[model samples]
Target chain A: MSETNPPIKIELVSDPMYLCGARELVSCIAHRIGFDDMECSKIALAVDEAMCNVIRHGYERATDKPIWVTITPLSESDESFGGIEIVIEDEAKQIEPTAIKGRELEDIRPGGLGVHIIREVMDSVVFEKRETVGMRLTMQKRADRPEEAPRISSRSSCPIPAERRVS
Target chain B: MRERPIAARAGGFPLSNDNFIDIEHPESGVCVVIPRHDVDMSRSPILRSAIKDEMGSGLSKMIVDLGDVQYMDSSGLATLVEAMRGAKNANVSLYLASMNAKVRAIFEIAKLDAFFSIVDSRDEALSA
Candidate 1:
């Protein structure tokens, strides 16, 4: 992630076909941010999973719904950490930010692992509503990221929605 | 992924889209399923259907040869997880072979690395 370059914003429909191209974009961006192939692929997969959630649950698989993804690079001077940040905005019906989650690994089932993947790959994940409608997902990864990212199950440990935020 | 013998052309046949899956049985009672291209959300359904169809057909053991896949997302993982459950019930042994570092990491992140029987090469999978 770099501050010198402008952030990349992507707008597309909820259709799943476009996700492959989106993943390639994020992986390339992560590569430019100095991450290795493994990390880059993880970042791309995480973003892909997030988009799948928006398309699956938020949009109910409606191919025509809109989803916006903004990827901003962070500099080392900002917080003594340099990495990548991605914000996903969905125009689907807004739900309680806390309600967004995946199934527990302990249960061992399919269909709810996307949320787990996003939290496990990224450094920090925050959710805030887009004022009146839709939801915004803000996920950031630090350059000195964890070799093993933390799992999220306790909702209390998560950051709450800010009084004011952007989509 | 190490270079290993792929029954790529031996008794190969497509299940759904001809490009998605190539089924081959190199030896008796062993079936190898090779999923082509990146196994993302869009491609996952095809892979899932192919696996489901194979499981429905009686087989002693199955190996999902993933040497050709460069990438896989949660949807791909979900498809395999579902296959795992189906395999367990059907008493059909399953093994995942030839995953590159990148695809294997996706499994590790989901904490499923411990659950599946994964091998490094296709020959190992076939002989196991």
Candidate 2:
């Protein structure tokens, strides 16, 4: 049902103020695409984190740089299963795809929390150097799972695998 | 200012200089800081500053009332972390209260929920 939807493109400046509008738009689209409340928030958060990174690190906080956001639907044919795909493109600084590694969540005072959230919430996250854009960060959140859905802590009562079960 | 729709829903508070945060000191030894809008990078500094002022006010406990806030990004989270550290050094306990599901999810995603004392209600926060 969602694949028939057209892609939505938003052009914004490298300013934090624009983030609110972008998040609102993304949420509206995600909702229209049948994402539940929690699913909508996770997808919106993934896009928010990406834009913040581009504005802060990619553009060095310059307010005039251009940031492009494209939202498209994911389908089983696309191997995304089912969800929303957010593509954030920046124009100022070229980023090494491999350099986008998220810092350890164990570290309290590190700069990678944004990256970590992007990774953990989204089912698939990919970064690439686009021909026209300086960098392209593509993230997809499957409608099938929310970030809080799968988190059963080590202390949970779920049956443990015998290989790693406490003896 | 621009917020507070018609009148104080429950109560009112004084806004900081930048007008980004509303600080309510309901009683002695406790301070409550509420941001009037979305807590993003641009506005986190104002909140951080307000939190700093409260830290030095000799309050024994500080509560960040998140009931009014709908969205909070990473910068906002970092501000709270820094405030937590400052509160510790200043002998003030920092508590986060009434976070909506979205804001609470942000904290959980960052794995910092356990790091902060998050309560479901302001009364719970006040009494705890």
Candidate 3:
């Protein structure tokens, strides 16, 4: 099996306005890939949250910092079983990867839901530290296809488990 | 005659002069904050500051009109959560109104629909 689809790459300043552009791009790409309106929005939202985290936490809101994003379609031969892979990189302070979890939902406050939102929308989320500096966050979401219906998880149908639901 | 400053500032994050947000005083002790753009990480700070300022000014009632917000991310959601917390601490009541389908879906996914007081219209929010 061979993977050959060229990934779409976008580089922008660590500004919120640019995140809107990125969201629009991701929504269009997801729609082009046959995702429904709701699904496309979810994917775009996940990407938006990830980029926001990089800017606010990773880059500490340094508008001059550069944020790089890559969107690649996972090949059918891969384990993702046909999905999209989004990689976001930033040159900001690196923190413990385990600290990325969203706050307990039961607490009902704000300021920490970004990480949780990413986890809820994407199938897999991974955070890695770069060799010298910076950090990389990778997220993947499998498409919903008729043939692979069972494999697709709907947030509405498969609610976040009681144990995993953060306060 | 002197003109009154319409928006308050929170810490270093001032209410941007840009068209991204609009703050309105619909009634006494009630402020309505509207985001004319997508609520994402980039724009959340502005919204947060605006809400904080409103809370600080002793506005015990708030209604966030999402009528113009077509899209929102977790960053945006977090701002709302923070505002809600601030409102509680100050003994204020925060209400959200006119959320579009997409924005509403994000809240549903996060299971925050149960946590926040969301109404269908600005009128309902005001009355609530």
Choose the strongest candidate by TM-score.
1
Q: Write the per-residue lDDT of candidate 2 for residues B54-87, one digit (tens) a residue.
A: 6885689989999878888888899898898888
Candidate 1: clashing pairs of residues: A1-A33
Off by over 4 Å in 2: A1-3, A76-81, A145-167, B1-18
Return the clash pairs for model 2, or none. none
Superposed Cα deviation of residue A121, candidate 2 (Å): 1.0
Cα miss at A140, model 1 (Å)? 0.6
Candidate 1 lDDT by residue in tens digits, B16-98: 23456777878767778898788887778777777877786568788999998988998899899999999999888899999
Model 1, residue A60: C-alpha shift (Å):
0.4
> For residues A1-167, what per-residue lDDT tens digits would candidate 1 score against the true structure?
34645789989999888897788788767766666667778888889999998899889989899899998877666344577889999888888889887678988888789888999999889988998889899998876654322221223332311211355
Instruction: Give each model's whole-structure lDDT.
Output: 0.79, 0.76, 0.76
Weakest 10 consecutive residues, lDDT, candidate 3 chain A? A149-158
Instruction: Please tell me how candidate 1 rates in CAPRI terms.
Output: medium
> Candidate 2 chain A vs. true chain A: TM-score?
0.79
lDDT of 3 at A102: 84
What is the CA-based DockQ of model 2?
0.41
Q: What does candidate 3's lDDT look like per residue over B53-121, in tens digits?
A: 668665778889999888888778888888877888898899999998889998988889987899999
